[model samples]
Target: MSIPIDDLPDIPADLIDEIKAFLRLDHDEDDPAIAEMAGSASLLCESFTRQLLVARMAQDMLPVKNVWQKLSRLPVQAIDLVESVAADGLTQELSSDDYIVDIDSDGQGWIRLQTAVSVSRVRVSYAAGLVADWEEVPTMLRQGIVRMTGYFYANRDSNDVHQLPHAVSALWRPYRRMRMG
Candidate 1:
């Protein structure tokens, strides 16, 4: 399960204006609505590519088992909290020495226990993504978001984007390699 500990980043208003520039239109009359479109497009692009455009805190819960298990999101930035909740509603904070975080698996994150516990007891709080702020988001992702926002804004009349666009595809291919199909 995925538990978000913070609010997802908002699509910057300036970006909405950039999309507007691309579409050759202007004014704050529709700025609020256009900004909303930018956010929606960011969501779609992130979902399609399985990438977190901005860093956020989240907790991923995994069932107990002897083997290693993958974390909920990609490009695992850091692991903050590790706790094991028992069947009788008891939660024990796990020591950092007890487990390992393996982000070397490309985009995927992995964790393995040093010792076994009861079933369904593992919980991990971590930061996962490329950057922590919208201003610091990668150029490719930002461009992709702008393009996607343009697509969404233009398609308001028809809603006919049947699939992900090629430019976005090219931007995401390498990142998608480690994501499970």
Candidate 2:
């Protein structure tokens, strides 16, 4: 059975009201209502974060299986659309980071491909000190000075560097395989 958004636990109306109240307070800093609203929004954010983590896990495991099974029953034309997009380089590396392989109910679906690469800095730290002089410097200064920085980078520099090549290929695989057979 598919998990529905409606089935998820609801956010209380009072909490939502508080969020609105806080937003209003942000505009008018003198309002005492802002404090209560800020507190409510913080609590709500934490609650939603937890719920989102659970939901993501369920989505990753469950919906993938269900979608694949459903796709298997789709018409040949839908599969063909996917193959056409793949052949046309719709999943090419210059696109954004996410791609949609749509298989419409009418047996005609299209592939929308996006590719993105993100680079971020990673800090590595080391401590080198005379064992006897370790206590002379403040802990905060020592910690700050001992850090080294490096970048974690990924880019689709070429057409082959795209992350979803298999998913894109899989989108058309059924049709191609069928044609071959």
Candidate 3:
């Protein structure tokens, strides 16, 4: 179900042309139009190159697996445990915390976790859940919660961008509470 970069919508020719024009490639002889074009092309090329590298890395790291199919094979009790934990409603019986948890279909064929909690005020956020790989569940849970808490702790170092882990942790806390309860 994954769409390759080639399958994505084409970048607009007008935008490219506008970018080219904005660089003022036709100006001075020392910094001529050709040099400007080359500079612009180089920038664009580098962006695409980085994107491809990241895509490849992600593909290599995350292999395709039939998560739902495997989950379906679990015993009814185990399946219920997963459902309840994922749903987050089971937290109420275990804690008096005013938190609401919900699941969302990511449209890309995965489920995500959303949480709304009231401290001094109501705060809401969401976290992307891991693919249904039971073996990766523990690590994924930790990572996903961190991400939802607004902290970007990916396995690999990214382009110097740090995500907020607090938001991710907030979203995932309920699920953890439910499981323990």
Score each candidate by Cα lDDT: 0.76, 0.26, 0.26
Query: Per-residue lDDT of 22-108 in model 3, one digit per residue for the tens?
Result: 444343442333334333332232232222111111100112222321111101111111121223323221131322222323111
User: Which candidate's lDDT is highest?
Assistant: 1
Task: Point out the higher-scoring one by lDDT: 1 or 2.
Answer: 1
Judging by TM-score against the true structure, name the best candidate.
Answer: 1
Candidate 1: where is the Cα deviation over 4 Å?
Answer: 87-90, 105-107, 178-181
Alpha carbon deviation, residue 155, candidate 2 (Å) = 32
Q: How well does each candidate superpose onto the true structure, as a TM-score?
A: 0.84, 0.16, 0.20
The total of clashing pairs for model 3 equals: 17
> What would the per-residue lDDT of candidate 1 be over residues 16-73, giving only the tens digit for each residue?
7777888788567878778888888777766766777688877888887767888877
Candidate that beats the other on TM-score, 1 or 3, i.e. the better one: 1
Candidate 2: which stretches are off by over 4 Å?
A: 1-8, 25-181
